[model samples]
Target: MKLVLVRHGETASNVRMVLDSLPPGPPLTDLGHEQANVLADALADEPVVAVCASTAVRAQQTAAPVAARHGMAVRVVEGVQEIFCGDLEGRSDREAYGVFVKTASEWADGRLDLTLPGGENGRQVVDRCLAAIERITEGVTGGTVVLVSHGGAIRLAGQALAPNVTASLAAGGLLPNTGRVVLERDGAGWRCTAWSGVDIVVD
Candidate 1:
Protein backbone atom coordinates (compact mmCIF):
# COMPACT_ATOMS: atom_id res chain seq x y z
CA MET A 1 0.00 0.00 0.00
CA LYS A 2 1.16 3.53 -0.71
CA LEU A 3 0.16 6.67 1.17
CA VAL A 4 0.20 10.21 -0.17
CA LEU A 5 -0.17 12.85 2.50
CA VAL A 6 -1.01 16.41 1.47
CA ARG A 7 -1.38 19.59 3.45
CA HIS A 8 -4.36 21.77 2.70
CA GLY A 9 -3.92 24.99 0.75
CA GLU A 10 -3.56 28.40 2.29
CA THR A 11 -6.48 29.96 4.17
CA ALA A 12 -7.57 33.26 5.66
CA SER A 13 -6.49 31.92 8.99
CA ASN A 14 -3.21 30.90 7.46
CA VAL A 15 -2.55 34.34 6.05
CA ARG A 16 -3.52 35.96 9.32
CA MET A 17 -2.15 33.20 11.50
CA VAL A 18 -5.44 33.34 13.41
CA LEU A 19 -6.37 29.70 13.01
CA ASP A 20 -5.36 28.92 16.58
CA SER A 21 -7.61 31.62 17.98
CA LEU A 22 -10.91 31.08 16.19
CA PRO A 23 -13.74 28.65 16.85
CA PRO A 24 -11.85 25.82 15.11
CA GLY A 25 -13.23 26.20 11.58
CA PRO A 26 -12.21 28.35 8.66
CA PRO A 27 -12.73 27.99 4.95
CA LEU A 28 -9.99 28.41 2.36
CA THR A 29 -9.18 31.68 0.68
CA ASP A 30 -9.20 32.31 -3.09
CA LEU A 31 -5.52 31.55 -3.36
CA GLY A 32 -6.16 28.37 -1.47
CA HIS A 33 -8.64 27.32 -4.11
CA GLU A 34 -6.08 28.02 -6.80
CA GLN A 35 -3.49 26.03 -4.93
CA ALA A 36 -5.82 23.07 -4.69
CA ASN A 37 -6.48 23.24 -8.39
CA VAL A 38 -2.78 23.24 -9.06
CA LEU A 39 -2.35 20.26 -6.79
CA ALA A 40 -5.12 18.39 -8.57
CA ASP A 41 -3.42 18.95 -11.90
CA ALA A 42 -0.13 17.74 -10.53
CA LEU A 43 -1.61 14.47 -9.27
CA ALA A 44 -3.76 13.84 -12.32
CA ASP A 45 -1.62 10.96 -13.44
CA GLU A 46 -1.26 9.18 -10.09
CA PRO A 47 -3.47 6.17 -9.37
CA VAL A 48 -5.34 7.37 -6.34
CA VAL A 49 -7.70 4.80 -4.83
CA ALA A 50 -9.17 6.94 -2.07
CA VAL A 51 -9.25 10.56 -0.96
CA CYS A 52 -9.42 11.42 2.74
CA ALA A 53 -9.32 14.81 4.41
CA SER A 54 -9.70 16.48 7.73
CA THR A 55 -13.21 17.65 8.66
CA ALA A 56 -12.09 21.23 8.59
CA VAL A 57 -13.42 23.20 5.65
CA ARG A 58 -10.01 24.18 4.40
CA ALA A 59 -8.88 20.58 4.20
CA GLN A 60 -12.14 19.41 2.62
CA GLN A 61 -11.96 22.16 0.06
CA THR A 62 -8.40 21.27 -0.80
CA ALA A 63 -9.23 17.60 -1.23
CA ALA A 64 -12.38 18.18 -3.26
CA PRO A 65 -10.66 19.14 -6.51
CA VAL A 66 -8.34 16.16 -6.48
CA ALA A 67 -11.12 13.76 -5.57
CA ALA A 68 -13.25 15.15 -8.37
CA ARG A 69 -10.45 14.75 -10.87
CA HIS A 70 -10.02 11.12 -9.87
CA GLY A 71 -13.77 10.43 -9.52
CA MET A 72 -13.34 9.47 -5.86
CA ALA A 73 -15.45 10.44 -2.90
CA VAL A 74 -13.97 12.61 -0.19
CA ARG A 75 -13.86 10.90 3.20
CA VAL A 76 -13.84 13.09 6.27
CA VAL A 77 -11.63 12.05 9.17
CA GLU A 78 -11.64 14.11 12.33
CA GLY A 79 -8.43 12.57 13.55
CA VAL A 80 -6.46 14.34 10.80
CA GLN A 81 -7.68 17.78 11.77
CA GLU A 82 -5.18 20.45 12.83
CA ILE A 83 -4.13 20.78 16.42
CA PHE A 84 -6.77 22.73 18.29
CA CYS A 85 -5.48 26.14 19.41
CA GLY A 86 -7.93 26.53 22.31
CA ASP A 87 -7.92 30.10 23.64
CA LEU A 88 -5.46 31.08 20.93
CA GLU A 89 -7.93 30.59 18.11
CA GLY A 90 -8.73 33.71 16.10
CA ARG A 91 -5.84 35.67 17.57
CA SER A 92 -3.26 37.41 15.38
CA ASP A 93 0.34 36.19 15.14
CA ARG A 94 1.59 39.00 17.27
CA GLU A 95 -1.00 38.22 19.87
CA ALA A 96 -0.27 34.50 19.98
CA TYR A 97 3.39 34.13 19.01
CA GLY A 98 4.67 34.32 22.55
CA VAL A 99 2.43 31.58 23.79
CA PHE A 100 2.99 29.53 20.65
CA VAL A 101 6.73 29.79 21.06
CA LYS A 102 6.54 28.76 24.68
CA THR A 103 4.33 25.80 23.92
CA ALA A 104 6.45 24.73 20.97
CA SER A 105 9.61 24.98 23.04
CA GLU A 106 8.05 22.81 25.65
CA TRP A 107 6.95 20.33 23.02
CA ALA A 108 10.47 20.22 21.56
CA ASP A 109 11.86 19.60 25.01
CA GLY A 110 9.91 16.29 25.25
CA ARG A 111 7.06 17.69 27.26
CA LEU A 112 4.51 15.89 25.13
CA ASP A 113 2.10 15.90 28.05
CA LEU A 114 1.35 19.59 27.74
CA THR A 115 -1.82 20.63 25.92
CA LEU A 116 -2.72 24.02 24.62
CA PRO A 117 -5.53 25.68 26.52
CA GLY A 118 -8.67 23.99 25.17
CA GLY A 119 -6.54 22.02 22.68
CA GLU A 120 -5.08 18.56 22.39
CA ASN A 121 -1.45 17.70 22.95
CA GLY A 122 0.95 16.30 20.32
CA ARG A 123 0.71 12.83 21.82
CA GLN A 124 -3.08 12.74 21.46
CA VAL A 125 -2.90 14.03 17.91
CA VAL A 126 -0.28 11.42 17.00
CA ASP A 127 -2.30 8.60 18.57
CA ARG A 128 -5.47 9.43 16.68
CA CYS A 129 -3.64 10.02 13.41
CA LEU A 130 -1.81 6.73 13.75
CA ALA A 131 -5.16 5.00 14.19
CA ALA A 132 -6.42 6.72 11.09
CA ILE A 133 -3.39 5.57 9.11
CA GLU A 134 -3.87 2.03 10.31
CA ARG A 135 -7.46 2.09 9.17
CA ILE A 136 -6.48 3.37 5.74
CA THR A 137 -3.74 0.80 5.34
CA GLU A 138 -6.14 -2.01 6.20
CA GLY A 139 -8.57 -0.96 3.50
CA VAL A 140 -5.94 -0.40 0.82
CA THR A 141 -4.12 -3.46 -0.43
CA GLY A 142 -2.35 -1.63 -3.26
CA GLY A 143 -2.39 1.70 -5.09
CA THR A 144 -2.12 5.21 -3.74
CA VAL A 145 -4.29 6.71 -0.98
CA VAL A 146 -4.46 10.47 -0.63
CA LEU A 147 -4.97 12.25 2.67
CA VAL A 148 -5.50 16.00 2.74
CA SER A 149 -4.89 17.32 6.24
CA HIS A 150 -3.55 20.15 8.35
CA GLY A 151 0.18 20.88 8.43
CA GLY A 152 0.64 19.93 12.07
CA ALA A 153 -1.30 16.72 11.70
CA ILE A 154 0.63 15.76 8.59
CA ARG A 155 3.90 16.48 10.38
CA LEU A 156 2.95 14.16 13.18
CA ALA A 157 1.97 11.51 10.69
CA GLY A 158 5.40 11.78 9.06
CA GLN A 159 7.00 11.40 12.46
CA ALA A 160 5.00 8.24 13.00
CA LEU A 161 6.37 6.86 9.77
CA ALA A 162 9.97 7.79 10.57
CA PRO A 163 10.29 7.55 14.32
CA ASN A 164 14.07 7.16 14.45
CA VAL A 165 14.82 10.31 12.43
CA THR A 166 14.89 13.55 14.36
CA ALA A 167 13.03 16.41 12.65
CA SER A 168 12.08 19.94 13.51
CA LEU A 169 8.56 21.26 13.21
CA ALA A 170 9.93 24.44 11.67
CA ALA A 171 11.70 22.51 8.90
CA GLY A 172 8.24 21.89 7.33
CA GLY A 173 9.20 18.42 6.10
CA LEU A 174 8.63 17.71 2.44
CA LEU A 175 4.86 18.13 2.45
CA PRO A 176 4.04 21.76 2.08
CA ASN A 177 0.59 23.10 1.33
CA THR A 178 -0.66 21.20 -1.73
CA GLY A 179 2.50 19.11 -1.66
CA ARG A 180 2.65 15.32 -1.36
CA VAL A 181 4.71 12.78 0.56
CA VAL A 182 4.70 9.12 -0.36
CA LEU A 183 5.18 6.27 2.10
CA GLU A 184 5.20 2.56 1.32
CA ARG A 185 5.23 -0.50 3.49
CA ASP A 186 8.40 -2.59 3.32
CA GLY A 187 8.58 -5.93 5.07
CA ALA A 188 7.65 -5.20 8.69
CA GLY A 189 8.17 -1.46 8.45
CA TRP A 190 7.24 1.60 6.40
CA ARG A 191 9.67 3.49 4.21
CA CYS A 192 9.47 6.90 2.67
CA THR A 193 9.42 6.63 -1.12
CA ALA A 194 9.24 10.30 -1.89
CA TRP A 195 8.86 13.69 -0.27
CA SER A 196 7.82 16.40 -2.71
CA GLY A 197 8.24 20.18 -2.41
CA VAL A 198 11.50 19.86 -0.50
CA ASP A 199 14.99 19.65 -1.90
CA ILE A 200 15.67 16.32 -0.24
CA VAL A 201 16.28 13.40 -2.58
CA VAL A 202 13.77 10.56 -2.49
CA ASP A 203 13.95 6.99 -3.64
Candidate 2:
Protein backbone atom coordinates (compact mmCIF):
# COMPACT_ATOMS: atom_id res chain seq x y z
CA MET A 1 0.00 0.00 0.00
CA LYS A 2 1.09 3.54 -0.66
CA LEU A 3 0.08 6.58 1.35
CA VAL A 4 0.30 10.13 0.10
CA LEU A 5 0.28 12.40 3.10
CA VAL A 6 -0.66 15.89 2.03
CA ARG A 7 -0.74 19.04 4.12
CA HIS A 8 -3.84 21.07 3.50
CA GLY A 9 -3.82 24.29 1.49
CA GLU A 10 -3.33 27.70 3.04
CA THR A 11 -6.10 29.35 5.00
CA ALA A 12 -6.99 32.95 5.90
CA SER A 13 -5.24 32.50 9.24
CA ASN A 14 -2.18 31.18 7.46
CA VAL A 15 -1.68 34.43 5.62
CA ARG A 16 -1.73 36.39 8.85
CA MET A 17 0.32 33.83 10.76
CA VAL A 18 -2.33 33.08 13.36
CA LEU A 19 -2.63 29.80 15.26
CA ASP A 20 -6.09 28.52 14.43
CA SER A 21 -6.17 24.75 15.03
CA LEU A 22 -9.69 23.84 16.00
CA PRO A 23 -12.88 23.13 14.11
CA PRO A 24 -14.57 25.66 11.85
CA GLY A 25 -11.14 27.11 11.45
CA PRO A 26 -11.13 29.77 8.76
CA PRO A 27 -11.90 28.65 5.21
CA LEU A 28 -9.32 28.42 2.46
CA THR A 29 -7.97 31.72 1.33
CA ASP A 30 -8.41 32.51 -2.37
CA LEU A 31 -4.91 31.29 -2.98
CA GLY A 32 -5.71 28.27 -0.88
CA HIS A 33 -8.42 27.18 -3.29
CA GLU A 34 -5.97 27.61 -6.14
CA GLN A 35 -3.44 25.54 -4.24
CA ALA A 36 -6.00 22.81 -3.76
CA ASN A 37 -6.54 22.67 -7.51
CA VAL A 38 -2.83 22.33 -7.95
CA LEU A 39 -2.85 19.43 -5.54
CA ALA A 40 -5.51 17.74 -7.59
CA ASP A 41 -3.51 18.32 -10.75
CA ALA A 42 -0.37 16.88 -9.20
CA LEU A 43 -2.16 13.64 -8.37
CA ALA A 44 -4.14 13.46 -11.59
CA ASP A 45 -2.03 10.64 -12.93
CA GLU A 46 -1.67 8.55 -9.77
CA PRO A 47 -3.70 5.47 -9.09
CA VAL A 48 -5.47 6.90 -6.08
CA VAL A 49 -7.79 4.37 -4.46
CA ALA A 50 -9.16 6.28 -1.50
CA VAL A 51 -9.20 9.78 -0.08
CA CYS A 52 -9.15 10.87 3.56
CA ALA A 53 -9.21 14.26 5.22
CA SER A 54 -8.88 15.55 8.72
CA THR A 55 -12.07 16.64 10.43
CA ALA A 56 -10.94 20.22 10.04
CA VAL A 57 -12.66 22.31 7.41
CA ARG A 58 -9.44 23.30 5.74
CA ALA A 59 -8.42 19.71 5.24
CA GLN A 60 -11.80 18.79 3.86
CA GLN A 61 -11.62 21.67 1.45
CA THR A 62 -8.17 20.60 0.34
CA ALA A 63 -9.39 17.08 -0.30
CA ALA A 64 -12.40 18.20 -2.30
CA PRO A 65 -10.76 18.50 -5.69
CA VAL A 66 -8.80 15.29 -5.40
CA ALA A 67 -11.78 13.28 -4.14
CA ALA A 68 -13.98 14.60 -6.85
CA ARG A 69 -11.39 13.81 -9.48
CA HIS A 70 -11.19 10.21 -8.27
CA GLY A 71 -14.97 10.01 -7.83
CA MET A 72 -14.47 8.86 -4.22
CA ALA A 73 -16.06 10.33 -1.16
CA VAL A 74 -13.72 12.05 1.29
CA ARG A 75 -13.27 9.99 4.42
CA VAL A 76 -13.19 12.29 7.46
CA VAL A 77 -10.98 10.39 9.81
CA GLU A 78 -10.67 11.25 13.50
CA GLY A 79 -7.48 12.06 15.40
CA VAL A 80 -5.56 13.26 12.34
CA GLN A 81 -6.21 16.98 12.60
CA GLU A 82 -3.67 19.59 13.59
CA ILE A 83 -2.38 19.69 17.13
CA PHE A 84 -4.54 21.77 19.41
CA CYS A 85 -2.85 25.13 20.09
CA GLY A 86 -4.18 25.40 23.66
CA ASP A 87 -3.54 28.96 24.82
CA LEU A 88 -1.72 29.59 21.60
CA GLU A 89 -4.92 29.36 19.63
CA GLY A 90 -6.03 32.67 18.18
CA ARG A 91 -2.71 34.29 19.07
CA SER A 92 -0.70 36.35 16.61
CA ASP A 93 1.52 34.39 14.26
CA ARG A 94 4.66 36.09 15.50
CA GLU A 95 3.91 35.09 19.06
CA ALA A 96 3.19 31.47 18.18
CA TYR A 97 6.41 30.90 16.24
CA GLY A 98 8.65 30.66 19.28
CA VAL A 99 6.36 28.30 21.12
CA PHE A 100 5.96 26.23 17.98
CA VAL A 101 9.70 25.78 17.62
CA LYS A 102 10.17 25.20 21.33
CA THR A 103 7.52 22.54 21.63
CA ALA A 104 8.62 20.85 18.42
CA SER A 105 12.18 20.66 19.68
CA GLU A 106 10.95 19.15 22.92
CA TRP A 107 9.13 16.48 20.98
CA ALA A 108 12.25 15.76 18.94
CA ASP A 109 14.28 15.44 22.15
CA GLY A 110 11.81 12.76 23.25
CA ARG A 111 9.97 15.06 25.63
CA LEU A 112 6.63 14.15 24.12
CA ASP A 113 4.80 15.18 27.27
CA LEU A 114 5.52 18.85 26.75
CA THR A 115 2.91 21.14 25.20
CA LEU A 116 1.81 24.73 25.18
CA PRO A 117 -0.23 25.87 28.17
CA GLY A 118 -3.53 24.71 26.72
CA GLY A 119 -2.43 22.55 23.77
CA GLU A 120 -1.81 18.86 23.27
CA ASN A 121 1.61 17.30 23.66
CA GLY A 122 3.48 15.63 20.82
CA ARG A 123 2.60 12.18 22.08
CA GLN A 124 -1.11 12.89 22.03
CA VAL A 125 -1.10 14.41 18.56
CA VAL A 126 1.26 11.93 16.92
CA ASP A 127 -0.53 8.96 18.44
CA ARG A 128 -3.82 10.14 17.04
CA CYS A 129 -2.36 10.65 13.56
CA LEU A 130 -0.74 7.25 13.56
CA ALA A 131 -3.92 5.54 14.69
CA ALA A 132 -5.97 7.38 12.12
CA ILE A 133 -3.62 6.43 9.30
CA GLU A 134 -3.46 2.85 10.52
CA ARG A 135 -7.21 2.53 10.54
CA ILE A 136 -7.47 3.85 7.00
CA THR A 137 -4.54 1.91 5.58
CA GLU A 138 -5.41 -1.38 7.26
CA GLY A 139 -8.25 -1.92 4.87
CA VAL A 140 -6.20 -0.91 1.84
CA THR A 141 -4.12 -3.65 0.28
CA GLY A 142 -2.91 -1.88 -2.82
CA GLY A 143 -2.97 1.39 -4.75
CA THR A 144 -2.30 4.91 -3.48
CA VAL A 145 -4.37 6.96 -1.02
CA VAL A 146 -4.38 10.55 0.11
CA LEU A 147 -4.70 11.87 3.66
CA VAL A 148 -5.01 15.63 3.93
CA SER A 149 -3.67 17.02 7.19
CA HIS A 150 -1.79 19.89 8.84
CA GLY A 151 1.91 20.65 8.56
CA GLY A 152 2.85 20.24 12.22
CA ALA A 153 0.93 17.04 12.79
CA ILE A 154 2.22 15.38 9.60
CA ARG A 155 5.84 16.15 10.32
CA LEU A 156 5.49 15.02 13.90
CA ALA A 157 4.00 11.75 12.76
CA GLY A 158 6.68 11.47 10.07
CA GLN A 159 9.37 11.86 12.70
CA ALA A 160 7.71 9.23 14.83
CA LEU A 161 7.55 6.82 11.92
CA ALA A 162 10.74 7.74 10.05
CA PRO A 163 13.06 9.37 12.52
CA ASN A 164 16.28 9.14 10.52
CA VAL A 165 15.29 11.43 7.62
CA THR A 166 12.60 13.36 9.46
CA ALA A 167 14.49 14.36 12.62
CA SER A 168 16.26 17.36 11.15
CA LEU A 169 13.15 18.49 9.30
CA ALA A 170 10.94 17.89 12.34
CA ALA A 171 13.18 20.08 14.48
CA GLY A 172 12.13 23.01 12.31
CA GLY A 173 8.75 21.98 10.88
CA LEU A 174 9.67 22.21 7.20
CA LEU A 175 6.47 21.27 5.46
CA PRO A 176 4.78 24.02 3.44
CA ASN A 177 1.13 24.33 2.59
CA THR A 178 0.04 21.37 0.43
CA GLY A 179 3.40 19.72 0.98
CA ARG A 180 3.39 15.98 0.35
CA VAL A 181 5.16 12.86 1.61
CA VAL A 182 4.95 9.41 0.12
CA LEU A 183 5.11 6.23 2.19
CA GLU A 184 5.07 2.72 0.86
CA ARG A 185 4.40 -0.49 2.70
CA ASP A 186 6.97 -3.21 2.10
CA GLY A 187 5.99 -6.59 3.46
CA ALA A 188 5.06 -5.92 7.07
CA GLY A 189 6.59 -2.47 7.53
CA TRP A 190 6.26 1.01 6.07
CA ARG A 191 8.96 3.39 4.88
CA CYS A 192 9.05 6.89 3.45
CA THR A 193 10.17 6.98 -0.15
CA ALA A 194 9.71 10.68 -0.77
CA TRP A 195 9.26 13.47 1.73
CA SER A 196 8.27 16.94 0.65
CA GLY A 197 9.47 15.88 -2.77
CA VAL A 198 8.55 19.27 -4.09
CA ASP A 199 11.94 20.38 -2.81
CA ILE A 200 13.53 18.36 0.02
CA VAL A 201 15.22 15.11 -0.97
CA VAL A 202 15.22 11.92 1.07
CA ASP A 203 18.17 10.13 -0.47
Best by lDDT: 2
> Any runs in candidate 2 off by more than 4 Å, and if so which?
198-203
Each prediction's number of clashing residue pairs: 7, 3
How well is each residue in 1-203 modelled by candidate 1, as lDDT tens digits? 77888988988767866654222477778999999999999889988899998878888899999999999889987677777777876677675767765665565445768888777786887789888888776756788889988766676677666543235632335355687666777665676665665433344
For residue 65, give model 1's deviation from the true position in Å. 1.1
- Report the poorest 10 consecutive residues by lDDT, candidate 2: 194-203
What lDDT is reached at residue 44 by model 1?
91
- Alpha-carbon deviation at 48 in model 1, angstroms: 0.5
Model 2 — TM-score against the truth? 0.93
Show the lowest summed lDDT stretch of 10 residues, model 1.
163-172
lDDT (Cα, tens digit) per residue for candidate 2, span 1-203: 78899999999888888888897587898899999999999999889999999989999999999999999899999998888989888888665778877888888777999977788999999899998888989878889989999888888887777634456666765778899977777567667777787434444
The local lDDT score (0 to 100) that residue 56 gets in candidate 2 is: 91
Please list the Cα RMSD from the true structure of every candidate, rounded to 1 decimal place.
2.7, 1.8
